[model samples]
Target: MKKVIEKKVYNTETATLIAEYWNGLGEDDFMYCEEYLYRTRKGSYFLRGSGGPLTKYSESNENQTWGISTIIPISKEEAYEWLEANDKTEAIEEYFSNDIDEA
Candidate 1:
């Protein structure tokens, strides 16, 4: 995997708060910063953030700020393996045993 480092500039007010948050992070303090592919009911795919097994799906669309329709956790190793196996597919979307409720 290629590592790309991009710098983002936040406004002075936001920068202060962000810097504080960054400084507060200890070695063990980490969030699930991995991006995983999710396939919607329409068969369209999109990348969304994964917060591992404990992450909850928002009850309302209005509360879903992450642009994630669902929370399905896939590990980096598994994602890489799928990419290797399928020449045309870069990422793999898993289907649940039970149909997901849209309500």
Candidate 2:
């Protein structure tokens, strides 16, 4: 399965959209995706997931310091596509199987 990396939002509306999308997928189908909510300085939010690269690029970038505040199960493909459509290419990468949890 292809994975999308990350998404950043500054408001609740976007966060709601993410939640809605996850809920729409149905619980039985959630194994295909993973979603996480992160907070940076000043309350900024980040929505990220596992799938692509084994190496987390953010660990080498400024976002390495960002704190993950929550985690949820969502469609990995959907998140990846959204990132691609929105031109968030920097959020996508190749990841190793061991880096992700099978759950």
Candidate 3:
């Protein structure tokens, strides 16, 4: 028989914040971070296969796997706070700096 691995990868505080943002999901709501790698940012996480904002699917044509999505706590001082709180990972080079770009 194959072993069923547990899917909770987050530390207590991060997990608690995520739970608050996306409440009502059950234990099996979705896969965990360790199931696949993820990039955690100030207000959201970008999964491997994300196709930017315009496309729902990932940009890679050869890839078959759909990208994952995650919720993040929203606040005005989010980016600064996030860097201070978490490990100092690589700096994000590109991001939408304007609200109009989202549409």
> In TM-score terms, which candidate is top?
2
Ranking by lDDT: 2, 1, 3
Model 3 spans with C-alpha error above 4 angstroms: 1-31, 34-68, 71-73, 89-103
lDDT of each: 0.30, 0.36, 0.29
Supply the global lDDT for candidate 3: 0.29
Ranking by TM-score: 2, 1, 3
The candidate that wins on lDDT is 2
lDDT string for model 3 (17-69, tens) is 22111223333333222111223333433222222222343223464433333
- Give one clash count per candidate, in the order shown: 0, 9, 0
Candidate 2 residue pairs that clash: 4-80, 52-94, 52-95, 53-93, 53-94, 53-95, 54-94, 54-95, 54-96
The C-alpha RMSD in Å for every predicted model, in order, reads 17.9, 15.9, 13.8
lDDT computed for candidate 1 = 0.30
Off by over 4 Å in 1: 1-32, 50-82, 85-103
**Candidate 2: tens digits of C-alpha lDDT, residues 1-103:** 1122365334433343322122233333323234444333443334554321222211235543321223333345545555555544344443113333444
Writing each residue's lDDT as its tens digit, candidate 1 over 19-58 gives 0011232333233233334333433333333332223322
Give the C-alpha miss distance for residue 73 in model 1, angstroms.
17
